[model samples]
Target: MKLKQAVTGMAVLACMSTAAHAQSAGTFFFSTGWFHLAPQSSSDPLTVTSIGGSPTNITEANTGASLSSADTIGFTGGYFITDHIATEFVIGVPPTFDLEGSGSLEQFGKLGQAKQWSPTLLFKYYFNAPTASFRPYLGLGVSRVSFTDAKITNSNFEANVLHGPTSVSTDSSWVPVFNAGFTYAFDQHWFAGVSISYLPLSTTAKLNSTSTTVVGTLNIQSQTKIKLNPIVTYANVGYRF
Candidate 1:
């Protein structure tokens, strides 16, 4: 009858209102999805810093490296402080990148590989009202960047270029991140988002090699400074609590 119809209409309206205010204050959200990382990378010439525990600065000519693009799963967790402000923490399953030899080292092809880890925390400002279905945001943050499993994987390069058996190590540092993205709420609890971030980062790869001369085995220490300015893209689906 009329009473049942009225109740049903009111219920529908209530559902719509709930869905409309998905990004309101005091909301906590979590998302998981894909991250693609592309590095605008460059490196200083490879240098032999020391030989047999003695200082000998010898730089190679046209010997540098480039990093290959990588992809991995990414996650984001955030809390809304207000209708237009939020804080988020982002991380990814560390992706391994290939180091391709450049310039004078180009003939060696694959120089090495390493896994990169960068966990970031961002303070964001969202544009538009809380009730809107789509919102865009800009964020500023810092990342703790590190590397692991770095090594000279090419044996030919290790023997001919390094002139020995070589092992690798890398330095860690802190870098700033610039981020921007947008989210579209499907309802009160479900949403989809895409984001892009940039980081200006650099690290040094240190190499230790043992070479056998006519005399004996000599330990050689060498290093190269590399700039890895990467642009990262993320696409995810999320739920709000």
Candidate 2:
């Protein structure tokens, strides 16, 4: 009876130690990754006329611009609320874009490049033990994005007869965002993850008239609306403390 009791006590102690170790395994992490923004619906409206005395409405004519490939990078920190649940804060930079066209007669340019800073709050649930092998997890979060110091270049016009120059400037606004992601751990301190986030943003731009040495200065005012969706992918090396 005494031997049996001693063995039972040892077993209980070993189980407790294992649980404690797993609970305190990791408390901090950092990651860097590359991201891209998928195309979303965009519109531009302008009131101008062709030199042939024809009405030209950019938006009504579906003559706008498309964006190009962009790069994104971010950092994150997390704290465990329970043994299998944690909350994290993620911050990222605004992605830059270059404009393309669909072979329309409208004037096209780079439009501008935008940069954003976002702070997101997330909740994570770990389904398996935080081991040195594969550990998969899920997260959900809300983000706030800001755009700054955006610049535009290559804003010119091309037509059969009207060959001249034009320019545009813009201002940005705050947007609300949401994201979902999964992370795969290769070791106790390294992992990779991919996430997708949606942003509801719009802006307005000022159109400037240009001269082709004959048409002189043509004063014009126009408005543009832009909506975006960004998908982020990342691979990181982290440490547990």
Model number with the top TM-score? 1
Q: What lDDT, from 0 to 1, does candidate 2 have?
A: 0.56
Clashing pairs in 2: 94-116
TM-scores for every predicted model: 0.94, 0.64
Mark the 10 consecutive residues where model 1 has the least summed lDDT. Answer: 15-24
lDDT string, candidate 2, 96-122, tens digits: 666554336334544445555567787
lDDT of 1 at 62: 95
lDDT leader: 1
How big is the positional error of residue 181 in model 1, measured in Å on the Cα after superposition? 0.8
By TM-score, how accurate is candidate 1?
0.94
Residue runs of model 1 more than 4 Å from their true location after superposition: 1-17
